[model samples]
Target: MIEGRMETRTAILRAARTLFLERGYAGASVRSVASAAGVDAALPIHYFGTKQALFLEALPSMPDYQPLLEGDPDDLGERFVRYVLEEDGHLRPLYLTLLRASDAGAVGEQLRDLHETTFVAPLESRLAGQDAELRARLAAAVVGGLMYALWVVGDDQLLAKGEDDIIRRYGALLQHLIDDRL
Candidate 1:
């Protein structure tokens, strides 16, 4: 029963994410998420309490970073660069939706909290004792910048380039900086 419930919750989150991304948060509705999840509208409310809560639950999963970082952290810089450049097209929609929703004040606070807790705090912990604050800020900036750049690339043809090419060209520079600095 517990496992089934967990799966249902996960499904709701996944569906909510897809719908929220497809139709900005303001455009997405509980009914849409429920229909996407193949569950009734009340189920999402029962599991997540609100659409904002559902969006927050799905935020961490948006970038799908686990596979990229699951292996050796030693090659993280290259892998990170590759992951974003390759997967950016698929991931940009979510970021666009989130940014729009965030700007609209629909989910700004929750998004900020999610970012601070999940990304900033973790980066701070990892870089502790080695210019912790600066490192944390840099890490956040790099990640956010990468996402934003990818978003821009979606609309701007002048920035056209493949993921592997981007990684091959700039990965070493970025990696060296990260490695040498920390």
Candidate 2:
């Protein structure tokens, strides 16, 4: 019985993630997750209480960024871009879900918090000289734009660029932001 309950919970979480990514928080219903999980609709409610709760539960934990930060500072931007592109399919839905959330709501706040903790703070620490925070913000903005342009908007010209070209070109731009002086 305990095993079955655990399995059911796992299934619900997986289903919730897929549905949330596919349909967004507002778009993904408890019923839909339940259906996908092969459980009764009440089961999700029983486990998670509310759709918002379930959405939070389903959010992917941030991967350790330490390794990505370990390399030479000059290549950091390229490394970052490589990491971003390597993640291709995984992060698309995450950002998509963020966009789907209402800016004034709980989900939006959660996403914002995640962005700062998982992104900005780390970069701020790495950056040196005047206006580190501003530099970090600009660098983070470029990263966000790359994600939106390549994955979210699915721009052909930008997406079509070879990995080496991106690492050479976009990486340089990001690095410039990271080294901002004024």
Candidate 3:
């Protein structure tokens, strides 16, 4: 019974993650999650109490990005850029979901909180300037804009550039932000 319950929960969560990413919080419905999970619609409510709770539960644990930050100051930008560009990176989907769901009330608030705490806070701490937090946020905006162009907006011109060229050029931009030289 316990094993079956666990399987059901896992199925529900997997379905929820995919739907949340595909449809965002506003569009992903419990019935749809249940349909995707091959379970009854009520199953999610039984397991997670609410769609918001289910969404939170379905959110993957973020991978540690500290290695990117721990490298030499000069190389930190390249490292961070490369980490974000890695093939089949896991965090991208989570990030996309967060961005898409960011205006959906409580779930959006939680996603923003998770993003700031998990990703931005550490970067802010690494900065040395006055208003380091603000600088870090601005850096996030730059990086986020680039990411949106590449991943969300599908900007083909940006995508056509060779990886190394993008790294060298954009890495400098990121470096300037990280160093608080911007």
Candidate 4:
């Protein structure tokens, strides 16, 4: 019985990730995920509590930015850019999923909260200046655009460019913000 329950939970989670990716959070429903998983709709509710909870659970775990934060302040931008471009393959889907569903009602709220907590707040704490919050937000926006262009739109030109070039250019932009030069 325990094994059966575990399988059911795993199946539901797998289906949720697939449907949520294919159709944004607004479009993907517990019913649909349950259907895809071959489970009763109530099972998802029972295990995950709510669609928001399920969505959060289905997302890839957030990468730890602590190491990036601890690195040399001068190299923070390059570190961030390199981490996203090279090490954060698992996070691509999460960015797309959040972006696509951002305009939806509760998901919008969730996205805002996630953005603040995950990206803005930590970076904000590291920044020095009266406009630290604004700078962090601006940097976050650049990161978002980069992810969207690379993963969602699949910009061929950008994709064709070497990673080093992107790291240098984007890193400088982020570094400017980090340094409060802008």
The parts of candidate 4 lying over 4 Å away from their true place are 1-7, 26-29, 46-50
lDDT, candidate 4, 56-154, per-residue tens: 788666666777877787988888888888864568777788888777667778788888887899999999977999999999998888888888888
- Where model 3 places Cα greater than 4 Å from the true spot, the runs are 1-3
**Candidate 3 per-residue C-alpha lDDT over 120-157 given as tens digits, one digit per residue, 9 for 90 to 100:** 89888777768788877877787777788878988888
Q: lDDT score of model 4?
A: 0.86
lDDT of 3 at 65: 68
Worst 10 residues of 3 by lDDT: 80-89
- When 1 and 4 are scored with lDDT, the better candidate is 4
What global local distance difference test value does model 3 have?
A: 0.81
Please give the distance, in angstroms, between residue 131's alpha carbon in candidate 1 and its true position after superposition: 1.9
* Index of the highest-TM-score prediction: 2
Colliding residue pairs in candidate 1: none
TM-score of each prediction: 0.62, 0.88, 0.87, 0.83
| Clash number for candidate 2 | 0
Task: Give the clashing pairs for model 4.
Answer: none
Clash counts for all predictions:
0, 0, 0, 0
Model 1: per-residue lDDT, tens digit, 29-91?
A: 888888888887799999988777777776545454545535564566777677666664666
Candidate 4 weakest lDDT stretch, 10 residues = 87-96
TM-score of 4: 0.83
Candidate 1 vs candidate 2: the TM-score winner is 2
Q: In model 2, which runs have C-alpha deviations exceeding 4 angstroms?
A: 1-4, 102-104
